[model samples]
Target: MFLIFDNFIFDLDGTIINSSKEVFQCFAMAFESVNYDIDKTRLNPDIIGPPLKEIIKLIAPELNDENKINLICQNFRQIYDNDENDCSELYDGILEFLKKLKKHNKKVFMATFKPMIPTIRLVNKFKLNDLFDDIYGIDKFGKHITKEEMIEDIISKYNLNREKTVMIGDAPTDVIAAKNTGIFGIGTLWGYGSDKTELKKNSNLCINNIKELDSNCEFERILK
Candidate 1:
């Protein structure tokens, strides 16, 4: 019997984890290390799921040079890396959700703007590395890697059919990425990017609860 959705591509950070605590702490550390104190609430510091370059540009518009961006990123990573796991925690029901997906024989993956190294670390640290066949993340240069690369990689990695894949995320980026790759995109309202201003506006489906993500969604433009 065929399943409703075969492959599940998940965006980390806000989608599966309530990582704001660790995120704010790391950013505060990063700024403090550079002697630049930051007020987390004032600066809107919970931007872990958005594209890094976009967040950087908004936060430090004065430092437009590549080198300065690199430095800030390095500092952030330096502080973020020391005890990266300190503030990171999986969202409620997330582990069970993964187990359910795996029980259904569906392929799961990570597709996020976070750099590959830390992303890998957190996954492994939380014992989630074994849950996915292909885990995708941003490179060290802070480039905005599209979800297409991730989808193509997963397809090539597992020989998957594009029609069988779906991207689950909170931000518009994830929705756009899925569409660009010719796959269906679903957004979660329980994330930082709730209500899909630009992301879910074009999404095929969306759910407020992660548990509501399976099998019951109304198909929009899917082709057989």
Candidate 2:
């Protein structure tokens, strides 16, 4: 069976791009710049899915000051965005899969928890602007929204039929957001952010390889 959806929403960090190395390094450097020491274990790939502030809170639970948190996030952006070497790369077969979607006239969008500035930068760097109908971040246009809200906004703004849409990501949050928005959720096992057990439990479907999503591959039907 081929499970097909006309509208596809993707998560960026762990899904479209493998950004763990750059993200973890910058996170550590950001805390150091702020004179705060974070448990190195807390900077692991598991923390890559959430918004920056939330991740900060998780890694440094002792810091309750909002101003300090904001400062840390700013420092992180400075370090990460200024890096000349692009450490991130699209997962193997991702580019081909995206191009296949576009070739099939599928409407594709990206909804990520990362802020808008870096999101746009990465998209432009990879020359992926033409692949998606639109891209969204947690702080798009200065309005902070959760992943669920972002999905809802995309659906409403584009008048997408919920039944014909699917969200593809590597985090449990991604599956939750899609379900909350009444859409199918497909989990990718190759990404860093998710634990295989939890992701498989929450997702409508799970695939171990990016190539599993290729246009010619057999897709297990999404159970509603």
Candidate 3:
């Protein structure tokens, strides 16, 4: 399966690391500091994939102004930065899969809506720098950036072959981004995307588990 693609771009939060617990805590603490009330139960599963600032705005709209939103986001960053390693864990087989990709001479990269500071921090913390060729994340100020834009940046910068490059993620946006850019998208069931139906509908291939990356049937579908 990995042999077919010369280059791979991945999403950070759900696709690469299961950081939902830490993310939820960051949101909860920041929301509390801003005096905005939110339920912990409402945080997880739905709120994992989107940009932190955007999620903060949606869940606690009362933090209406940019100033207030920025304040909460800042606090969230502090909390997350304090104990990122303890909070998140890489999914099983991820390290081995990445090593395999490198061994196969495939170029790997990351494109996530997460802010750049923590994104780089996490990558460095996990010692994943050698495995990935490049990593892209939103600006520090939390400016608006789309998935398509991120993919395009990677495409323009590296001159990647769209035909041989694929965007793999846990969300439908991933598929839409790749489809818009005339490439392939592979959706994963292990991520935070609640609507698996939509992901399958938009993606070139939707795999139920990480091990399926090694499945002959799944890879054959991509070739077809």
Candidate 4:
């Protein structure tokens, strides 16, 4: 079962940067800026990976209309964009892992659903841009870049062999994206999209920590 992927595409949110604390803080700041006086502690958990507009609609269900959702979403961007000093930080051990992947000669890139603008900001804000060779993120859904498509784009962007590219994420969506392109999918247990049961279906395998990924290539080759 041993197989090796020469290229790897990764998800940003729960998979790499555990910015729950800062995200929560930013969500609260956004609403407060809009005169809503929202509490981040309560709203933070829901803001993990989805777009701010989606989170705004979920949190401010009372304002179900489109216009209000847009406004609140704008508020969110204001807060998230205002400061990078607090909103983005790589999860501990991430740098070590990325360096290892680089040393192994694996092409590494980020293929996240996170909008391109903020994704760029977050990477540079935290000085993570150097670790990745390419960054493929979409600004909006209807722009024709399906989340899954980003995986394909990254694989092709680097001219990677389909059998040698892996997509590592925390959601079932990640699995669909990877399989859509005949690539490998690896899930993380420390994220929001999975419990033990869901893990079995969505990924070729699941891992608990990035540090555990020291032996990841061996496991991925076998599992896939």
Candidate 5:
């Protein structure tokens, strides 16, 4: 049987919900609002998993004005945070897997770099608010915290056992965070970060399907 963990920390963007397209659209809208010409082709899909500040810095390095960056970021959040669900969709089997975790008495939490307001909105919109024990988003004061910091904080706040905790995410940053925070990391291939070599090198386990979270495959097991 797969090793069952007591606490599971999940990443929001590519892991739990497919919000990359919406993210890109928001960026586009933000540029339009400021009459800044944005070359849509320059926006990479891999940019979705990182913090919004990082994304802005990467995509618009020439826009050095902090005020402008904040304005764009705010505009992006405003458009994407609306009640209407645009392109966001839950990955196949995620809802069912979450239900199973809940039934198994697992403590679920979301650790995302997305701002708190929009993150909570999406969680509630997807009707997933009840499943998570706690949610960690970027600070309201615009302080950008790393995934490692967020995971460490969660561990301390919840008094979780490091030996029985796991981080589930789709990016290298997530794996790094789990490793830095002394927890097992499970990388999902179905999401945006499909680099198996990178994931296998960092994560304790890597799963292509949600059901594989409980797989008995010897190769997939994290024996610790």
Candidate 6:
């Protein structure tokens, strides 16, 4: 299964590193600092895949004011970015799997909803720069874009063959992006945002562990 694709695009937060703790903590602090009341239950790990503003809306739907939303986002960034001790850790077997892909000369890239500043910070913190061919976030500039658009940009920029490219992620958005861009999507079960039913329905293949990508592990495939 792994040999079929020459290129792999991965999601960052839920797919590669588990940043749920850091994310939730920073969001909580941000909301408190902004005097916004939120349901703590809405701050679960499932909300980690989308952009900060989207996540804020989901967690605090009552916040309809654009100015307030922007303020909260700014506060969250200040709190999260300045925290030297980010509790994000790579999922088990991820490092080894990435190395295996590199050894096989596969082209690997990252397409994360996280902004470039913190994305680069995490990549550097984890010492993953050498493993990936390139890394991308929601936007390099202030332009608003969808995850599908970001994926499409990566495909076009690299001239990746759709048939030989796969997007591996833990969220339905990731699968949807790959589908929208005409590439294969591999759903990972071990990540924070994984919804078994949603992923099983949308993904070309679903993997339980990162090691499965290197082995002939049995996977659930939904033929579209």
Using lDDT as the measure, the top candidate is 2
lDDT of each: 0.72, 0.86, 0.80, 0.71, 0.81, 0.84
Q: Per-residue lDDT for 1-224 in model 1, tens only?
A: 12366788999877887767777776666666767644456345335576655666656666556876777778877776667447677877779888877766778888887878778778878899778877788763356557678777777888877888888888877888888888888877777742457766868887777557644533322323
lDDT score at residue 177, model 4, on the 0-100 scale: 81
**Candidate 2, 103-190: lDDT as tens digits:** 7778899999888888888998899999999999988868888889989999999999998899999998899888899999999898
The TM-score between candidate 3 and the true structure equals 0.88
Candidate 2 — which pairs collide?
none
* TM-score head-to-head 4 vs 5, winner: 5
Q: Choose 3 or 5, whichever is better by lDDT.
A: 5
Clash pairs, candidate 6, are none
Alpha-carbon RMSD of each model = 4.4, 3.4, 3.4, 3.6, 3.6, 4.4
Could you tell me which 10 consecutive residues in candidate 4 have the lowest summed lDDT?
A: 38-47
Task: Give the TM-score of each candidate.
Answer: 0.84, 0.91, 0.88, 0.85, 0.88, 0.90
Output the lDDT of residue 63, model 1.
57
Tell me the lDDT of model 2 at 17.
96
Model 1, runs deviating above 4 Å: 1-3, 43-46, 64-67, 140-144, 215-224
Once model 6 is optimally superposed onto the true structure by TM-score, how far is the C-alpha of residue 221 displaced, in angstroms?
Answer: 22
Off by over 4 Å in 2: 215-224
TM-score of 6: 0.90
- Per-residue lDDT of 212 in model 2: 75
